[model samples]
Target: MPRAVVRQRDARHPALPRRAPTPPWTRWAAPVLLAVTVVVQVATPRTLDLSFLLAAVPPLAALAYGPAATALLGGTVLLLLELPHYDLGHPGESDTATVAFVAALSVLFAAVRSRRDAQLVSVRTVAEAAQFAVLPPLPEHVGPVRCAGLYRAAQRGTLVGGDLFDVRRGPRGVRALVGDVQGHGLAAVGTVAALIGAFREAALDQRDLVGVAARLDRRLVIDAEDAGIAETEMAESAGDTGAAGTAGTAGAAGGAGHGEPAELFATAVLLEFAADADELRVVSCGHPPPLLLRGGTVTELAVSPGAPLGLGLAGVAPPEQTAVGLRPGDWILTVTDGVTEARDASGAFYPLTARLAALTEVRQRDPAALADAIWKDLVRFSGGVRDDVALLVFAWER
Candidate 1:
C-alpha cells in the first residue's frame, strides 16, 4: 500500500513521500521582478510610475515558498519600493500606500496557501488509511518462502493505485494474489477492495486456486449490480457525467443491469507456494505469467491464461494450474502488465525476460534483489511509466 518496499543489494522498501522542493524559477523571478520595478521607477520620472509593478513580487513568492519565505520576500519588496524614490527627496503617500497594500496582499496569499496545504495533508492521511485497511503489507516471510512486494501508482503524489497484491498463510500452505483493476482512481480502488476481499475469504473457504478466481469473479458481478443501483439513484438526484473515457466504461459496467454489459472486471494471478519449497502453483486470469529465475537462466512460466474475472461466465474450461519447479535459490516474480507494457521513448516495450536474464549474477537466489533490479531497470528503460505497477517476488530457500 505504501507503494515501496526495500529493494536490491541493499535496497529497502521505496522511500516515503516528502515535501517537494521549490522550483528554481520561483527563486529567481522574485528578485528579477524587484530589480525591474526599481529600474522602471527610476527611469520613468513621476508621470510614468512603475511602483505598481513591485506588487507582483509577493504573489509570485507566495506560489513558490512557504508562509515564512513568502513573508520575508514580501517585506523585502515593500522596503525596496521606496528606494528608487529615495534620491528624489521625500516621496508621495501614494508610494507608502502601495507598499502597505502589497504587504497585506502577501500575508493574505500566505494564509490561503497554508489552509490549502493543511487540506491536502488531511486528504492524504485518509487515503493512506484506506489503502492500509484494504491492501495491508505482505509478510516478508510466509511459510517456506521469502517474499516482498511493491506497488507504484501512475499518478504522481498518490500512494495507492489500481494495481494490488496480497499474501496469506492458510491451512493449505501460502496463497498470494496480484491483480490490476480495469481503470484508475477511486473506482479502480473500489474494485481492488472488492476483489481482494473476495480473494481473502475465498482463499480460505475454497480448497483450490481456480476456485478462488471463480469466487472473485462472482463477487465482482454482485458489486457491479450494486454500483448500477447506486448510479441509477445518483442519476435521479443529479445529472451524470457522460460516459466516454475510462470512467464512462466503468460506469457502464456497473450500471448495465441484468442482460447488459456489466463493467467491473480485473486481471489477476493466483499463486500457492508449497510448504516444502518444491514448486509454485499458478492460475492466471488474463494476467502476465510469473517469471522463473533458475540456474542462471530466467524463464516465464508456461501457465495457461483464462478470461478476466467478472464476466459472470466461467473459464470455458476450468482454469489450468501449472506448477513450476522451485529448487533452493530459485525465484518466481509475478507482475501486472504495467511492467511488460512500459514503453520507451521509441515505443518499444520493455524486454523483461532479456533484462532479467542479464541480471542473473546479481539477482540470483534473492527475491528482493531481483525485484529491485527489475524495477530500477524498467524505470531506466522506459524513461518514465504511465500506468499502475504491482510486483511480487518469492524466493525458495531451504
Candidate 2:
C-alpha cells in the first residue's frame, strides 16, 4: 500500500495573529511630536511655553514602548526641556521637579498597559477553548464520504465566531449543517452554539428533513425567550410573526423591533447523504448554495431559498428537500458568505467556481488535497480575508 501525501494547505482563513506590541514607526512618534512642539514654542511671537506639550510624550512612550522605553524617553524630554534654561542661565527649581514627576508617571502608565495586555491574552485563550467545545473536530471519514473543514475568525486574536459547520451520523444518514449568524463576537458565537447544538440533537431524533428544521426553529424560540427579547411569546405562539432578515418568522430566533438589541438570525443549509440512496437531500435556509464538482466540472446546486433560522415556523411552509444525484468521485463544497463575499484589492469578489474549475486532477481525487487547493487559491484571491470563513468539503467514495 502506498502512503497518500496530503499537502497542508490553508484550510480556512488563517487565525488572526495577536497584534504585535507597539510598532517600530510609533516608537519615534513621541520624540517627533516633542521636537515639533519645542520648535513652535521657540519660534512663536509670544514665546508660548509649549513645553507643556512635552507632558504628553511620557504617556505616548508608555503606550508605544513600555516601561524601559518610557524611562529613556522621559530622560530625553527632561534634557530637552532643561536646555533652554541652561542657555538663559536661570534653571528653575520647580522645572526640575516637574521633569522628575513626568518620569515617574511614565513608568506608572507603562505598568498599567502591560497588565491590560496580559489580561487580553488570557481572554483570547478562554474564547478559543469555548469555540472548540461548540464546534468540535469533525471525523475525517463519515460513512462513505471523506470530509474536511476549516474556520477562521474575522477579528484578530478571536477563535470563536458567528460562522459554524457540523457533521453528524443520524438515523436517516450523514447529516451536515453550515450556517452564519447575522453578527459577530460573543453574541454571534452564542447564537452559533445554540444553532449547532440544536441541529446535532435534531439530526438523530427527527424522521424527516422538515422535522429537523422545525426542531431548530423551536430551539431558537426558546433561546429568544430566555434572553428577554422585546417580542413577546404571544406573537410567535400565535404564528403571526413574518420572516426576518433573510428568512424564518421574525423574533423567533432573536429578531427584536427597532430600538432593541437586533435579533439574531442565520442563513443555513442542511444536507443528508443516506447510504441506501445515490443522491443527496438538501434544505437551504436562505444560505448560499453548495457547489458540486464531478469529472472536473463544477455546478452550484439550485435550491429554492427558505427562511433563515431563528424565525418561528408558524405559517411558514416546510422546507422543500432538493435531491441531487451523488455519484462516486463527486465532491461537494459548502462555504459561508465569508468565502464567496471575499474581495480583492480591486474590490472584485473571489471567483470560487473558476478557481475550483482550475484544480488539478491530483487535487480533485483526495478530499484533503482538494481542501488545501481551495484554501490556498482563496487566500491568494482575497489577499487577506476580512471576515470569518468556514468551509466543508466532502468526497463521495462509496
Worst window of 10 by summed lDDT in candidate 1: 7-16
Q: For residues 1-398, could you state the per-residue lDDT of candidate 2 as single tens digits?
A: 11111223222313523443457777788889877876776666543466667777887788777788789888887787677642322336786677679788888888888788778767755655666688776678889878887666776655668898888898878899998988865568888888888998999998877778888877776776666543444445444434454234544443454234236578889888876888888999889999998886889999878898777765676678899999888889999999899999899999898888788575545776677667677788888787878888888888
- Model 1 lDDT per residue over 1-398, tens place: 22255232111223223233346687678778877777766676666766566778778877766678778877886566555643332346787677667767777887787778677767656666666777776677877878977777776655567988888875567899999988975558888888888888987888878888889888888888777677665653343455456556655554554233347888889999876557678998889988887777878889999888887647356577888777887778888889999999999999888887788776754666667677788889998778888898888776
**lDDT to native, each model:** 0.74, 0.75
Mark the regions of model 2 whose C-alpha exceeds 4 Å error after superposition. Answer: 1-121, 225-262, 345-347
Residue-level error in angstroms, candidate 2, position 158? 1.1
lDDT for predicted candidate 1 compared with the true structure:
0.74
TM-score of each: 0.78, 0.65
TM-score of 2: 0.65
Q: Which 10-residue window in model 2 sums to the lowest lDDT?
A: 1-10
Backbone collisions counted per model? 10, 6
What ranges in model 1 sit over 4 Å off? Answer: 1-61, 64-90, 232-261, 313-316
